[model samples]
Target: MSTSGSKDMSRRHVLGALAALPTLPILPVLFGASVARADDAPPPLPSWNDGPTKQAILDFIHATTDPSSKDFVPAEERIATFDQDGTLWVEQPIYTQIIYCLARVPVLAKANPHLAKVEPFRTVLTGDFEKIAKLSLRDFETIAVATLTGMDVEAFAAEVKAWIAEARDHRWKKLYTELTYQPMQEVLAFFRANGFKTFIVTGGGQDFVRVYSQRVYGIPPEQVVGSALGTKFGYDKAGRPFLTKEPKLLLNDDNAGKPEGIHLEIGRRPHAAFGNSTGDRQMLEYAKAGDGARLSMIVLHDDASREYAYGPARGLPDTRVGRFPQELDDEAKKGGWFIISMKDDWKRIFAFE
Candidate 1:
């Protein structure tokens, strides 16, 4: 048979076969295009394997941000505070700031042999980790002040800039400037996207952190608040206005002092707060107690594979040493806080080379 006659025979056979079977209701066919559209839809953010903790955070944020919601917070009150050291960057092994101070000891010792003989500086010069770790907070502060003294504010800023440019984190094999958490960077962006103004509240020297914070963390100099040495407003030999460093007014932005620093610098309570250690417990509490919807988050340094792990170290016997890990656990059990496990929550640590 010709091709058309053969096709006609095949159709007749198919019709005869269907006719032999029992009659059934017709069903609608779904097109590939429509099926694809349904399958390609993005999953809801808080539902995508984030667990209960992350879901609660997303729900809280959504509740506060939705204008029609009863829990909506005004944009003007959306201040977010962040603790710097272990919160945004690495503080394990040794703090980056302490490394900077220790680096200055050799130079300072050359000019003043008395520093070479001092407990902390002596420990630092001879690379005695045990002794360095044992120095009292008062002794450490004395060394910090001595190293920071004499230079004018502008000169001190320049020195910090230069030091940052050259200093590398011993564990990361990258400059201290490059040790910022990639995940936290995304969180900062997320806050900005959510109409929150951010500030870095830290225990490190404010002037030191402010030197590069804006470029590194997107926070402006005026928004960076931390421990500060006393400054003297003065004029140079040519009568130009200048600010000089003095050996007084040490505002240590650690432990209980964090709340005081926040009150002094931002002048308003924050609606959201992020931090990484027990040093930040009070700041988180202060943020959580604000009049409106608030979020308090702690970045737990649990990712040993990606970053170094540390608990609070026992400091030297004499000074007011800040509390560490056990306190962190207490804060966690206190509840109403978001605990972010770095290993579980972050896909990456620092920015890639």
Candidate 2:
């Protein structure tokens, strides 16, 4: 069979399996059901549980979209940003990337005896997280650069792709791809339906996000803005362009850097933002501070059954996790932001099989 024919057949098989499953209520249709007047349109997210918070979201979307409404916001200004780790993806037990790095330490140890003697990498190889946490920021950076060095950009991307294909969550025994939040997927679609351009502003590697985000998050490579390592463009003897790794210019996209990265890459301020943890505070602040209609949301990892819950901020080896109980309360009182409880808000956590 031709490649296209094989692809078509594969899609048909997947769709056929999906069709055999029980039908779930369509979100847009459910939203339309809430309107009493024949000519009136209901809110974009009617399937969401009804409450003051849900109503506030609906009212904000409507007030901002309707030209006749006092709070009308222009279509050009409808940019939304989202943080990836812990917000859209699972990051418990440990950050997913850190887990990936830990898995790789033994492999590196075989080639470089120096890694076996190092503080964090040594602790990582031994699964001694308590000792790993004692390493300084510089020590962490050394391990990261050493582990990530020497590979061309394309080779590195392929390695990540392969790793993801084989890697399962330690506790769940499911592919890392399977751990994404189902409700957030709907939220992404909902924003797209409302004429909002979505961008990912994450602390994860920019190139790493670009490789799989289109398939995973429906956010394209051009729409992803994140931390970056400098690369030099060069050509070999055959004159094929290649990206060479650099020893320097690594930009970390956490905390205050979030706002700077957004300003530099996205240019315009986002009107809507979603994140989890204190790393996102600056980005949320920047989005909320924008003039006109704006909304910011934080995803609280309170659901332990569906996902791993590991907050109240435990200090991780080489990284400081944000604990924001007081800040979350303050943001709630301010009314500009929404705190989504993963336990209560989501009816389902992962996508239907």
Candidate 3:
């Protein structure tokens, strides 16, 4: 993959809906030839191949969008939120951002020599991830703070962008962004095409995910909401005002925080929500709680061949990063939400290979 392409998916692993209106009459004509050939045209979710999972998505969109249906929602109220990490891309072995942090410790430690002797930093400096992984959450927090803070927002973003351009996944040997799931990309485009506003709600840092969200996921910066650290606004020597990242937690944006971020950032409850792990449980529940036609779905990583498989459902690796516990599975089933099986539903994984 090209450098930009790969950089687009690099992450530090942290890690809607409906309407109908008078515009409906001209909706078909809006696409010109694509509309003219509607009957003979292929499915909008082309990446889905043909399956029950795909059909469920189609049915939900149809029911919520049809003007005649009581379930029809207005275009303006069609807000859809998606969890990043395991939902949009991958969060296996560990979060990509953690890999970035590990790589950064050595650089940062050069200036702050004490970090080299720190527990997790000491382990990270030795390049022993197995040991690093065994460290407590507090240790990981220390590492994240050390490498990710102390820089101005613009500089930090540029640094992350630069790292993404150069970083390659250890296992795939491909650019991290190159690993974005193809079917989900199609789903994103599909929602946007149908007049829904899509927002990315993730636990990853706001500054981190915003760097490439537009380029990689077609979601703009304003539409991207995520966990953020406190930032201090000040002027540099040149009197240029800037926001410097602080080693303080601003918002978590995971579990219960997901709904809080959506309400605070997006201001509207999502009409549809998609996620892949336990961190997403509250967001799914929030979407389903909205009073109109709604959709809630979770992507199950069940395809070990094309991708990693671990879940709250499938007997797979138990992970601290993206845990899919049993309760999440039971909730999804009880709520009548769709559980997308990556192994069975998707014909392809990545857009490349």
| Top candidate when judged by TM-score against the true structure | 3
TM-score to native of every candidate shown: 0.78, 0.78, 0.87
Candidate 2 per-residue lDDT, tens place, 1-353, comes to 11112223444575567568777676337534332222243334433565655555555566666667686777777788999988888876666776666666788899888878867677777777787767777876776676565668888788778888789986778888778887777678767766678899888877877878888889999999898888988888999999976656567788888888988888888888889888898899888887777888888777667775545532212224544455554764585688877777776778742
**Residue 252 local lDDT, model 3:** 95
Query: What does candidate 1 score on TM?
Result: 0.78
lDDT digits (tens) for residues 1-353 of candidate 3: 11111111221110001122344556556544543344244457666768677877776676666666688888787889998898889888788887888888888889899978767788889877677778888888888888899998998889889998889887788888887899999888877866789999998887888999999999999999999899999999999899999998889999999999999899988889999998899999999987867889999888888888786465776766788877888888999788888888888888987
Which portions of model 1 miss their true places by more than 4 Å? 1-49, 110-122, 311-327
User: Would you list the clashing residue pairs of candidate 1?
Assistant: 134-316
lDDT of each candidate versus the true structure = 0.73, 0.72, 0.81
Q: Let me know the TM-score candidate 2 reaches against the reference structure.
A: 0.78
Clashes of each: 1, 1, 14
The sequence of per-residue lDDT tens digits that candidate 1 reaches over residues 9-98 is 444575567567676543113224433433343323311236654555556666666776687878777788899887888877777788
Candidate 3 Cα misplacement greater than 4 A, ranges: 1-42
